[model samples]
Target: MTPTTAPLLPPQKPFDPRTATIAIVTFNRSGLLSKLLDSVLEMEPRPGHVLVVDNASTDDTTEVVEGYRERFGDELVYRRMETNTGGAGGFSEGMRLAYELGSEWIWLMDDDVEVIPDGLARMGRWGERFASVQGRRYDFDGSEFYWQYRLSIPLGIPIPFAPAGFDDSGYREMNSGCFEGMFIHRSVVERIGLPDPRFFIYWDDSVYGWLASRLTRSVIVNEFVLKRTREIKQWDMGTRHLNASSDRYRYYIMRNRGIMQQYFRAHGAYRPALFAVGTAATFAKEIIRLTAVERTVRGTSHLFRGWRDGLKIARDRSFQTMPPLV
Candidate 1:
């Protein structure tokens, strides 16, 4: 008897930029948001729709969005939340709307970055091959953002890859990607559903990216799409780049780390004892970095409190499909 093999799939059709929806999640940075919108509008083959999810900014975010609405008319859709939903919520809602609008591809980004003129075109070129393609981000100083690397499943940390290793003709498979300049296909969204809004902030993008990787192939494209305009001061701890994040950020980091541990344990990604050890190591490293580098002990309490709450937080199975944004 002859062994049978699965039939080869047909080549994917070329992606159309006009079928893509650019979703920008903004907080109080109205000026940066406006600049980002301007850059998006200037793309040669502009996305069919630009969905701006305002996280209830207290500033003139509404005014800035209104100006863009006047210029782009219906092409720009601004949805302002009644309250701040953080990055997780904002992206979830924006993605839901984009999906409902029937966009073939949804590009997620933050207001702090500006897309290069040919960014969409480059992403479109690779759209046929990968379910999710993350473009490289350059810092304002023209340096590559080295920290935006693939996540190491066991260590639960981003592992940096050399820039020269990228292939210009295709993408390299990745386990995870950041929300910034992440171009996702509609089919991937249908498979994985939406990012868990309960995450509030930290680890949400990582979890969503990981979920997509489990269902379909996700890759990092060699082309540069976005430039991070803001400069983040970081105290390097050899392998980790510890940013001087806020107390709130610290809480989310610790809490989300716990939640992620639960996720890994449930999926058999790691043995419970091994995950516990890794968690303890992660917590210890964070505390040491905070004390030695930041010269501050203010976030210690928040860190412990977050760890406690995160372990108690329930696992959300409903993240497959996002609820409608009110």
Candidate 2:
């Protein structure tokens, strides 16, 4: 079940509609959300629907969304969750609503990110051109605070340049790692199911990409649509600081990674050795950085919490989903 396989869509399929519904999951960043929505609404092929899922924000997020709704009307669907479901839950609910509302596809973007150079419209074109293409995402990590993951080609071959034309079978042969920017197709969604809510945060997108790669073809386009938010601080931590740090961030990474491993093993596609190597390297990097930033035991505890919680969650299923962040 490679990613290139056809998706399981229902019968009586209509022509592939160019329209896509954009889902923006927002918390308390009303200013950032307003800016994000403004740019998205201005796209050339404006999304057929703009759906916003507010995660129980305490600030003026409601006011901002209402303003957009007053103007956008039927073109937009704004929803408020009874509790703050975190990013993973927000995406899950938003995607579910989009799928139910007859959207041909879904374009997911973070609330804090701002559109640049009309990237959304361009990415939508690319998604249409190569239905398997996963769209593009890049971080504005600044010069000093940068982060990038190494993408390895098969047989440990180094990929120095982009391949010509996505039509080449080898292009399909090489797997694409999922990053932030994603343009999800209907076929892939129908086959692979929605984003895993159990993955409250962290590796949820990566797990989805890995799963979609197994169920249907997926590739990450190099185009940059949204910019990583820099101005906003950690104001939305809310009352569950422990939940945010312990359960969501640290635990899910380990828990989901193991879950994914078990799933792939059942499918006879287990790559534990490869995962082990990658995980070790990642852990090493985090330890070195954490120690350098603050060599205290407190710092170590904060840094290693993800690893600790991930292990705990992997062992206990009850910890997978926290008590709905109200």
Highest TM-score against the true fold, candidate? 1
Task: Please identify model 1 stretches exceeding 4 Å from their true place.
Answer: 1-11, 160-164, 167-170, 236-240, 314-326
lDDT, candidates in the order shown:
0.78, 0.59
Query: What would the TM-scores of all predictions be?
Result: 0.88, 0.74
Cand. 1 TM to true fold: 0.88
lDDT of 2 by residue, 10-32 (tens): 22333233357888888998998
Minimum summed lDDT over a 10-residue window in model 1 is located at: 1-10
lDDT of 1: 0.78
Error of 1 at 223 (Å): 1.0
lDDT of 1 by residue, 213-305 (tens): 776667887788899877776775443456667778878877887667655665557455655665676678678767766887778888888
lDDT score of residue 315 within candidate 2:
53
